[model samples]
Target: MEQTWRWFGEQDPIPLDHVKQTGATGVVTALHHLPAGQVWQPEEIAKRKHVIEEAGLSWSVCESIPTEDSIKRGDANARRAIDTWKDSLANLGRAGVPVVCYNFMPILDWTRTDLMFRLPTTGYALRFDMIDFVAYDVFMLKRNRASQSYDPLLVEKAEQRIAGKSEEQKKLLETNIIAGLPGGASAQTRSSISSLIESFQGIDDETMRGNLFAFLKEIVPVAEEFNVRLAIHPDDPPFPLFGLPRVLSTASDIRRLLAAYESPANGITLCTGSYGSRPDNDLVAITREFAHRVNFAHLRNTTVEPDGSFYEAEHLEGDTDMVTVIELLLREEEEAGRQGRRPRIPMRPDHGHLLAGDIDRQTNPGYSYNGRLKGLAELRGVIRALTRGI
Candidate 1:
């Protein structure tokens, strides 16, 4: 595993110098200033790479190169979007970046109802409260047919939850749900979200999955040609929201995705926090099965509740057996080495808790520096311990 850190470019409060201090020699980032569907020029890619190199860090992976909504819907604009995506892929490969981690989630990306869910340790972690999300969906955003999306009992609870929220609290909930967190495709307003959902009116899961396959069929070949591995990130929370269809949420979904284009370029980003959100997803099994296809990994953990809500947990302390997961990944690397392939999977500590002085400073939600540094240190310790005496 090559340790990497996700940086939001120059605008990120945590600068590249700070990243180098964390002891992660690789940086996973993107040219976030560029909009989706636009080609990332080779010069721009080189420039960003130069910046990371200057900081004594290599640009190991592109965290994302935003998969535009048009691509996800497979609508009229999808052709243009796919072409531009290929152009970007070629540019990135030419720049020597190997992995690209992207998601196909419509509208929102890695959503949560609470961005600052305080943990028992007094540190804040990202959280998805089912009741809060449902309440905001059915009552706040007021999406059409939203009530029909949830269980009757859950709907009742959401109604009660909404009734208790003050106007200020309701606004906060709306912001957290749609106003966008760091690395999301875009920040959306209520009207924008409604329009986006309406745009996908007739597109159900089957239609959405078909669109994703169509995308892979066209793009995977280009990725393979460019020597770039396309790692599709799983749907955060691993569930549908705002009645939108999610194609990459479970192990079955991943199986279908990989089968769509059977090539080394086509792979998955193993995000434990995202896939582990669902109790039914066997994280260990998923890792072992997809080890060969894993181009990148987000090694984080989460504590799931029975009601579908979950909170970011310490890197090694949640529902996931972080040690076993790391052990499997190590074995994969060892096996690849034996086969004359040096596939060093790039991993970063994701969605860390807001601890110490980071709580008072202005920081991207779930991306505070001190918090992630703590996570990386812990994960590094695990790797060392597991590899000891081997």
Candidate 2:
């Protein structure tokens, strides 16, 4: 495993030099300024690569080239969106970036009601309280069929959750949900979210998945043509949200995704945090099973509540068996080398606790400098120990 850091272009509060100092030799980033459904020029790709190299880091993975909503919903503009996606893949391959990471979640990329869920030992961590999200979805956004989306008990819990929140706290929740993350990824508001979820009226999980396969049918060949690996990231929280279907969630979903194109270029970004959010997902088994098709990895862990609420835990402290996961990946890399398919899988610490001086500074919620630095160091040590043994 090659250690990589996700840097959000030049304007990121954390500088490139800071990344280099973190001992990450590779960078995972994207043309964040570009709109979702646009073609990425080869020149732009080269420029970003050059910028990364100039900072003493190689560009390892394209963190994302956004999968436009049009493609996911299989709308009229899907063909154009997919064409643009292929263009970007080609451009990336030409520029020598090996992996492209993306997701197919609707409306929001990743949702969290609490960005600063505090732990006594670790300071603040990102949290997704089901009750908070349901409260927002039902009472605030008031999406069609929102109540039906939850069980009676859960709906009551959400009602109780929101009923207690003060007006200021409620506003904060809305802002956090809709303010988006860094790199110009916009968020969905009450009005826009409802309108967007409406687009998927007739689309169910299987239908949406079929649409995903249809997308791969066109783009997978382009990826193979350019010797690029298209790594689809799993859905964050790995479940349905706001009555919309989430296709990329579990090992079963992973099997389906890989089976779609049956090509090496078609792959998965094995994100432990995202998949591990669900208690059913065995992180070690999933990583081992999809080792051959894994193009990139996002290594982080979370502690979950029985009712599906979760908060980011330290790299080594959460429910996920971090040592086993890393060991499996190291063995997978070694096994790949034994065959003719040796590949340096790029991985980054997915998200981290916002701790120390990072709390005082302006920071992206899950992307604080200090928090991820701590995570990367912990993961790097584990990787080093495993590789040295190997």
Candidate 3:
């Protein structure tokens, strides 16, 4: 495994010099300043690459190049959006960046209802409370047909929960759900989000799946031409939200994706936290099955509640079997090496708890320096122990 860190370029509070200290030789990032559906000019890509290289680190993976909503909805602008995405992909591949991780989730991307859920240790972790989310959908954003998506009992509980909150608390809840997290899509206001949800009114799971496949068909060939591996990130929370369709939440969903566009360039980003949010997803099995097609990995864990809510857990402490998952990845790497292929898979510690000195500083929601440093150190220990027979 090639250890990497996610660095939100230039504007990030954590400096590149600090990243070098974390023992990660690679960086996973994107051109966040550029708006969605815009072409990534070659010069901009070179500039970002130069900065990462100057810091004694390599840009191992382009975390994402923003799959625009136009493409997701298969709207009138989708053709232009797909062409721009291909242009960006070619530019990245020209720069020698190996892996490109992206997602096909419509509207929102990797949402959470609580960004600062305090853990028992007094540190904060990202959380998704099902009741709180349902409350937000039904009472706050007021998406049409939102109440119908959730269980009747859960909807009743959400109504009760919303009735008890003050205005300030309600606003914060809305912000957490739609204000967008670090590296996510642009923040959405109540009115804007409602309209976005309305735009997808007729797009169901099957429709959304078709749109994703159509988008892939156009871009995967470009990726293959440029020698870039396209890895579709699993849907965060691994379920539907805001009455939107979810097509990348389970093993069956992934099987369909890989089969739709058969090629090494058409792959998956094995994010343990995203898939592990659902108990039905067997992480070890998924890893073993897709090991050859995994272009990147986000190694994090989550402790899930019975009600479809979950909180970020220590990298090795959650429901996921970290040791076994890593063991399978290493075995896959060994086999790839035997076949004269690139053996190192770029992986980063996905998210970490806000702890110690990081408790007071203003940092990106789940991306504080001290927190991720601790996670990387723990993961490094595991990788070393597994490989050296220690």
- The number of the candidate with the highest lDDT is 3
Model 1 agreement with the true structure over 1-390: per-residue lDDT tens digits: 899999999999999989999999899999998876679999999999999998889999998888888887888999998899888988998889989888888877778889889889999999999999999889888888899999999999999999999999998887788746334426566777788789888888889899999988987887888788889999987989888898998889999999988898899999999999999999999999999999899999999998999999999999999999999998898789789765788999987999999999999888999899999999999988877734
Residue pairs whose backbone atoms clash in candidate 2:
none
Q: Can you give the lDDT of residue 321 in candidate 2? A: 94
C-alpha lDDT of all candidate models, in order = 0.89, 0.86, 0.89
Candidate 2 wrongly placed segments (more than 4 Å): 180-188
> Order of all candidates by lDDT, from best down to worst?
3, 1, 2
lDDT: the better of candidates 1 and 3: 3
Per-residue CA lDDT of candidate 3, range 1-390, in tens? 999999999999888999999999999999988877689999999999999999999999998998888888889998898999999999999999989999988877778888889988898999999999999999888877788888999999999999999999998888888755333335556777778788888899999899999988898998988889888999887898888889999999999999998998898999999999999999999998889889899999999999999999999999999999988888888788889776488999998999988888879889988889988999999999888862
Lowest lDDT 10-residue stretch of candidate 2: 179-188
Clashes of each: 0, 0, 0
Residue 197, model 1: Cα distance from true site in angstroms: 0.6
TM-score of each prediction: 0.97, 0.97, 0.97
